[model samples]
Target: MPPPILVTGGTGTLGRHVVARLHDAGRDVRVLTRHARPGESGIEFISGDLLSGRGVDAAVAGVETIVHCASSFKGDPEAARNLVRAALRAGRPHLVYISIVGVDRIPMASPIGRTMFGYLASKLATERVVAESGLPWTTLRSTQFHDLILMVARKLARLPVVPAPAGFRFHPVDADDVAARLVEITLRTPAGRVPDIGGPRVYGAADLLRGYLGAARRRRPVVPVPVPGKGARAFHAGANLAPDHAVSGRTWEEFLADQVGDAPAGG
Candidate 1:
């Protein structure tokens, strides 16, 4: 019998897609999660916590590849540390990590790095741990997800007038597009830091909100809000874009049409 392909955060936005693809391809899957879950056709949910190192070693046992997709707003670096330690003890399966683009260039170099770009710092710190860990590793840096942008737009639209960050732009990619690429990578030998992937087009934050409002069949005035700090400057300058490496993905306009075309009025 073949060993199961382990996926962290297998229930999350991106991890679920990875799990589905792997399962469809006839690969048995093991998911490390905080809650207990019933096993599926070819999927087994293993109880583990990456942040505290509890049950992580058992999850890593007998695995040949690990698609690490679990992440939090905080403690990402610590979680990676725990996973690395366990993988080493279990003979070091190929570690595939999903990270965000521009983490290295986001300029999180201060005592207050965690204030504005805390998530960026967390991802960067985790990247360092993965790179330095002595295990055979592959890291894929990707742009923001379309689902994330939609969530932000929905929140901003709740206000009578949305405050758009001045000069903020993102090249958002579809999560499934990223997941497909990731599964392809996972099926192969480790490649260190493959090319970055992004959406089909770049859209300003306000433009994205406008797209959402249009799809949701609501109207709201958008006002530009000035932002400070080098971190903000980086985002303003398209630090999150990957034009040269854009994936053939679902466009923002298309995603809005699918997800928001049926939203409640003013939702």
Candidate 2:
């Protein structure tokens, strides 16, 4: 029998898909969550909190592989450190982490870096922990998820005018696709850091907002707000895009279409 694989953040957007894929494959899958829930079917639920390191060791016991998917803009660094310690104590499991693209390129020393500091810093710290943990590990850096783009668009749509960061571009990949890749990675030997998985195409923030508005059948004028910063400069320079390595299927338009359905009858 294959050793049970423990999955942190198994209840989240991407983690849920990973759990489902692993469970369907008939693998011994265990999920860690803050609240204990009754196991359904063959899936096991282990109660644990990555932030406080509570119940973590118990969750790692007997598990040979861990897919570290749980992350927080505020607590990721500490949580990752805790998870690494627990894994080491429980016999150095193969650790796989999901990270965002362009973190390496984003300046951690500037004012722009300080703005989105929590999230970027935490994730960078987590990556370092996984790398230096002396355990077999793999880290997959992927671009922003399409759902995130939609969330921002929805929130901005509430305003009188949709304001987009000028010169900002994104290559938003689908969460499910990223999840599938993670599953594939988990089944193989750790490959350390792999090529980034990005969306089918790159689009500027204004174009993205227009796509969202078109799909939702809402008309809103997009105003470009120039955000001057090194971070913004990096994003504008395509640091967030893996054009040479555009991987994964599904485009932002496809995702929007699925979510909003067919555009209202074109006049």
Candidate 3:
């Protein structure tokens, strides 16, 4: 039997799906979560926090490869440092990291973007550490998830008119597809800084919202507001998309339809 693989953030949006995929493949799997719920059959769960390396060491024990999905977008640099140290001590050979597209090109937008930049910066810094550590590694940078789009659309639905950030375009990929690609990366030999993953096509923020409203049969007006700043400028310029390296299966429309189902008459 192969050695157990350790997955951090196994209960998160993408992590949970990854865990299920690994289990389905019949791989010996162990997850590190702050809270371990019972009835997660065919897998082992360990309670731990990534910030202080609390249960990280034990979780990595006897594990050959690690799918490191845990992250602190707000305090990325420090979190990356701690996780790198733990992975080093455990002598793990392969480390697969999931990061966002345009981390290097786009400036931080809101507080969340600033924090996410800090986190992506930390992931980049850790990427260097893994490269220098002589351990095999793969870094996958993906576009925004479909779930993020749905969340944004739901928030916009609250307003009589939906207001969208000007010029920002998204190729929203499905989280499940991203997870599948990540798992495939783990199964194969490490490819340093793998190709960028993106959704099937590019669509502006307004287009996404309109599609959502149309699907739900809501007739809310959409207002596009352009902000003046590097972040805004970058998004308006479509900095988050990589046309040359897109590897996603589901389109944004397909994803929205799946979530919204059929629109009712006169909805």
Candidate 4:
């Protein structure tokens, strides 16, 4: 049998899918989590915390590869550095880190950019950690997930009129598609900083809001409000898009369809 693979954030949105895929493919898989449930067949769960470096070494012990899907908006850089240290001490396993697109392109002055600056900055720091760790590593940058987009939009749809951020665009890829790509990457040798993975199509904020309203059977008007900031400008300039690497097949509409169980209420 091949060496076991360690998966951090195994219970997370994307990590769970990767774990499922690896398990289905009959690979020996171990997951690191803060809480490990008992009697879980076919998966070895280790109690660990990446942010504090607890049990990380134990999690990496005898593992050949690590699919790092865990991240925090507040403590990403520290968490990543800790993970890198643990992995290095454990013979430098192949590390796969998931990142967001436009981490380098989005200016910090924009509203959206300002709000995400801390998270993006931390991710950048984490990327640097992996790159300079002298370890074989692959980092994949993916666009926003469809579920995230809908979650925000759905919340906004609760108002009488949904307000869309002006000049903002999104390329919302399905989480499952991103997970599959991560799994594929993990199965192969590490490829450093590959091209980004984007959704099948791009949609403006208003269109996304309208889609949410339609799905929830809400007749709220999607008002395009001027969210003028450096962030909005950056997004308008296509900082959020991966025009060269739109590889995913699932569209936001299809995701919405799945949630609604048919076509949206009106269309």
CA displacement after TM-score superposition, residue 140 of candidate 2 (Å)? 0.4
How would the candidate models be sorted by lDDT, starting from the highest? 1, 2, 4, 3
Kindly list the per-residue Cα lDDT of model 1 for residues 1-267, writing each as its tens digit.
779999999999999999999998889999999998899889999998999888899899999999999999889999999999999999989999999999977777664545888898889889899999999999999999999998888889999999999999989999999999999999999988999899888878888778788888888998999877888888888887898999877888778778878533332
* Model 4: per-residue Cα lDDT at residue 55: 94
Q: Supply the TM-score for candidate 4.
A: 0.94
Model 2: per-residue Cα lDDT over 1-267, one tens digit each: 888899999999899989999988889789999989999876899998999889999999988899999976587878988998999999989999999888878776776667754477678888999999888999999989989899999999998899999998888898999998999999999999987888888888999988889888888999999987777788778878878767659888788888876533320
- What lDDT does the true structure give each of the candidates? 0.89, 0.87, 0.79, 0.84
- The model with the greater lDDT, 2 or 4, is 2
- Note the residue pairs that clash in candidate 2: none
Comparing candidate 1 with candidate 4, which one achieves the higher TM-score?
1
**TM-score attained by model 1:** 0.95
RMSD after Cα superposition, model 4: 1.9
- The better-scoring model by lDDT among 3 and 4 is 4
Count backbone clashes in candidate 3: 0
Taking the tens digit of each residue's C-alpha lDDT, what string does model 4 give over 159-235? 88888888789888988888888989999999999889999988888888888777767788788888656666777
Task: Flag regions of model 4 displaced more than 4 Å.
Answer: 109-113, 265-267
